[model samples]
Each structure stands twice: as C-alpha cells, then as structure tokens.
Target chain A: MDFAPLLGKANFWAYFFIMLTGLYGMAVKRNLVKKIIGLGIFQTAIMLFYVSIGSKEGATIPILTAADAAGRGGIDAAAYINPLPHVLMLTAIVVSVATLGVALALTLRLWRRYGTLEEDEILARLRGDPGGEACTPRS
Target chain B: MIQEINAAILLLLMVCAVAALQVRDLMGAAILFGAYSFLMCLQWVSLGAVDVGFTEATIGAGVSSALFFAAIFRTTRRTKD
Candidate 1:
C-alpha cells in the first residue's frame, strides 16, 4: 500500500539482494572456490551498509581542518559524520581478508590431497567410492 | 555523499556479484570480483568514508583478488555442472 517508505530505502534493499545472491552461491555451488567468492561478496555487502550509515548529508568527514579548528570556539559536532562505524568496518574488512586467505589455503590443500575441488567428488573419494582406495569402509 | 553515484554503484555491484558467481571460468570471476570491490570503494569515498575507500581498494580489490588468483591458478579453472 505505502510504496514511498519502501522506495526511500532502496539502497538497503539493494545490498540485501546482494547478500542473498552471495548466500545462494555459497549454499548451492559445488565448487569450493566459488563458495569462497560468495563469502567475500557477503562480507562486503554488510560492510557497505555500515559505511553508509556513518555518512551524513551536508556534513564532512570526521577529520577537522586546522582553519575550522582555529576559527571556531570549539566546533559543532554535527558538522562531521560519525566515525565509529567506519572504524568498526575497518576491523571487519581485515578479519574478512584473513578468513578468506585461510579458507583459500584450506581449499588448496583439499585440492592437492583429494585431486578435486568439487565438494561431492571429494566426499565420494573420502568415502572410498571411486576406485575403492582411500577410506576402506568396514561396516 | 553523492546519491546518484551510490545508486549506480549499488546496481553495478549487484550485477557483478551475480555475474561473478555465474561465470564458468574461476579466474574471470575473480577479476569481476575485483571490479565489484573497486566499485564498492568508490561508493565508500562518495559517502565520505575516505579511509574506508582506501582500505577496500588495497585489501578487497588488491589483496583479495590476488588471493583468488593464486587459489584459481593452483586449482582447476573450469566448472562442470
């Protein structure tokens, strides 16, 4: 019924869609590398949302120039955008990169040992299905 | 903050995310992901987050893409099914 409010927040919804796309890729894709790509997308969609909320219209970044500091009695806090979200997102980005690197390394190791990056094939070989070599199921 | 640029970047981001997932070549998808990250940094700068823009540019676009390329080169390139 009320489309105005919905349209006003188009940016948030767009990011939500991106997150959904990432989730779909992670959940449905059989390839380990593809899943890592999805994870990267998912992390960024959220970080983008955080950075946006910290910004303010008609306000500058949190840093203050010397001229503004020298001329004013103190300064209006409202003139600068919020810095907390940006700081938090910075930590988030670093952690996500570390996570991605470790994940890819694990994927590399999996590829080396199993000889395939596809999840199902890897599992099948682990279960000793093809060529009857690795696991040797005994029950 | 530039509202128009943010909107355009958001649209491009969504497209890139989907395309990166759908592409058959993992290396090509990694480059698309780099483009997505760079566009995201632009959005952050236009939103007045300069520090964030720089961080994303270096880490997301540069470092993460390099990681992906390394992973892809070490593993298979084409996907089946």
Candidate 2:
C-alpha cells in the first residue's frame, strides 16, 4: 500500500498527537491546576491545527508590501502564507491569557476558602467534615 | 521524510500526554502539559504558521503555565486522595 499521502501530510499527524496528549491530561488529571494546564495544551493544539492549514510549501511571511497595497505590483499568492489564521491566532492568544488570569484568580479564592487545593479536601471542607472530632461531633 | 518527522513529533506528544495523565503530582502534570504546548508550537512552526507558533509559545507555554502554577499554589499541591 502506498503511504504517500500520509507521508506527505506530516503536520496533520503532529497536530493530532499534540491534541490527544492535551485531552488525555485534562481528562485524567485530578488537580485543578493540572487540568487548567491541560486545557492550555489543548488550546495550543487547536491553534497549531489552524495555523498548519493556512500554510503552504515555501511560502514567505504574509506581510503585504506597499507596492502590493497600492496595486502597482501584482500580488503573488505563491510567495506568501495565508494571513487569516495568523490574525485569528493573535486574537486567540489574547483571549487565552485573559481566561488564564481569571482562572488563576478563582483558584486563589478557592484555596483561601477551602484551605486545600485537593478536590477531595475541598469537598470535605464544603461538607463541614474535615476528618476529625469536629466532623464526627461525638455525643 | 516530512511525514516521518510529523510522526515522531506526534509520538512525543502522545508520550507527554500519557506522562501528564499518569503522574500523581499535580505540579508535574502541569509541567507536562506545558511541554505538550511546546511540542505543539513546534508543530505549528513546521507547518509554516509562525504567528500561531508564537502565540502558542507565549500564551500556552508561558502565561498558561504561570497561571496553572499560581492556581496550584492557591490550592494544595499534594493530593489527599
């Protein structure tokens, strides 16, 4: 069997692997921070997928020259990479950072209230039974 | 040749994901997740998506990791269960 197409499409596989790793981490990790990190990884993988699809072999940066903008020179699509994905990625980056900041702030508040980062500990504190005489209230 | 390289990178990503999931330590998992982002950035670069790679490296590996670590600090780093 000819594996030519598969062999040629290296970017696809790389992105796929990265995506899987991130998702698995998010799914299996118990810690809140770890899960957030996993989410970051997952986002990154998506970004990679978007970017890869916008590129082509031997393409240059997508910056437009004054000559092209003025319409004095013909545009050469072959010479430049697609600019749309890049623009989108910039916006995504900003959003991701903002989200991360908010998530961190929330985590800090959670820590203060629960006195622990562990999921089980937080649940215990929420239940008002922190594994002690206070929790049991012996008669 | 290109496919082989991608396959290798993909394999690395899989390993990182497995490690992130298997690790008992939360901090370690966060770090692995960061590594996963880094690998993804490289993948983007290979695809000629420089802008995407730049953002991934900055927000994914840098800002996100910092946030996760901060969150970890706020929460318990150790697991009771």
Candidate 3:
C-alpha cells in the first residue's frame, strides 16, 4: 500500500463520529438546550467536512505573487490550495452565527413565556393548568 | 507521517465525542462538544484545509458554544437520566 492516501482519511472518520454524536444527542436528549447544543455539534461537524475536502498536500495559499504578477494567465499556481471552499466556509460561518443568535433569542422568549425551561413543564403549563395532580404524560 | 497525525487527531475527536455523550451533566456535554470542535479544527488543519479550520475554530468552538450555553441557560440543566 502507498499509505499516502490514508493521510487525510482520519478527517473523514472524525467528521462521521462527530456527526453521529450530534445526531444521537439531538434525538435522545429531551432538554431544549441539549437539543440546541446537539444541533451546534452537527453543524460544526459539517463545516469540518467541507473544509477538509478543500485541503491538499504541500499546497501554498491560492494568492497571486509579485513575481508572477506580469503573467497573462496569472500566477504559477501549481500546488495551490483551492480558494473556493475557503470563501464558501467564510459565508457559512457568518450564517451560522446569525442563525445561532436568533435561536438563542427564541430560547429566551420561551423561558419568559413559561416559568420553567423543561420541555415537559412548559408543555404542561401550555395545556392550561399545570397544577393538576393527575399523572399525565408531559408530551 | 501525515497519516499518523491525522489518526491522532481522529482519536482525539472520538474521545471527545464519547465524553460529550457519556457525561451526566448537560453543561459538561456542551463543553465537551466544544472540545470536539477544537480537535476537529486541528484535523482540518492537518488535511490542509486552513480556511475550514479557521471557521471551525471560530464559529464551531466559539460562537456556537456560546449560543448553546445561552440557550441552555434559558432551559433546565437537569436531566432525568
């Protein structure tokens, strides 16, 4: 085996595990906060995967140099990392932050609406009377 | 050489994921998830994805974790399990 191809393979597996962990947390955890955290993890894993795909071995930054500035076609760009993915990731990071801010704001509103943050407790309060002693499934 | 480094980062990521899952405390889990993101940034760096690593470190490890904690602060930290 050449073993060279395996160099970046670990990134793929790390992404996969991170994704699975996030998914598992999202699915199993009942707390709204936990769910949000899980979603964050999931998003992070995806970003990692996207970024890892653009990486190349022994590649320089994809920028034009003064020495190659006079060239008609552009710089001698051999072994240069892809710039497109970097640009895309920057956009994605901005979007993710915006969305997260909105989500946090919504969570605050939810807390204000109900005295408790627990999903079951909120549901009980929303159902009319939370003081009922009857044994009922929260959700 | 690169393979070994990648593998080490991968192992670190896996451990962080497991710790995030197995912890009984929700806050602890959120922090572990942040650590996982940090390791993942390193993994991306090893893969030559500097841009991705930068985003992961900032948004993933930084903003996302803060947002998650904020959301959690709005909700109950205790879990039935």
User: Following a full C-alpha superposition, what root-mean-square deviation does model 3 have from the true structure?
Assistant: 4.0
The number of the candidate with the highest lDDT is 1
Ranked candidates, highest DockQ first: 1, 2, 3
On residues B16-46, what C-alpha lDDT tens digit does candidate 2 reach at each position?
8667666777788778878877886777676
lDDT of 2 by residue, A1-139 (tens): 9877776676667568767766875675545666666676677667767777788767777766666556764567778888898789878778877877886787778878776665555666778877733432222
Q: Model 1 RMSD to the real structure?
A: 4.5
Per-prediction DockQ comes to 0.71, 0.53, 0.51
TM-score (2 decimals) of chain A in model 2: 0.78
Best model number under TM-score: 1
Instruction: Summarize candidate 3's per-residue lDDT along A1-139 as a digit string, tens digits.
Output: 8855654576777788888988986787656666666676677677767777776778766766665555554575676787777778778767777876886687678888875545666666777767633335544
lDDT of 2 at A27: 75
Error of 3 at B25 (Å): 2.2
Task: Tell me the TM-score of chain B in each candidate.
Answer: 0.92, 0.89, 0.91
Model 3's TM-score against the true structure: 0.77
Instruction: Show pairs that collide, candidate 2.
Output: A117-B75, A117-B76
Order of candidate numbers by TM-score, starting with the best = 1, 3, 2
**Candidate 2 segments exceeding 4 Å error:** A13-21, A64-74, A129-139, B73-75
- Ten residues in sequence with the least summed lDDT for candidate 2 chain A: A130-139
Model 1: which docking level applies?
A: medium
User: Each model's interface RMSD (Å)?
Assistant: 1.4, 2.9, 2.7
Q: What interface RMSD does candidate 1 have?
A: 1.4
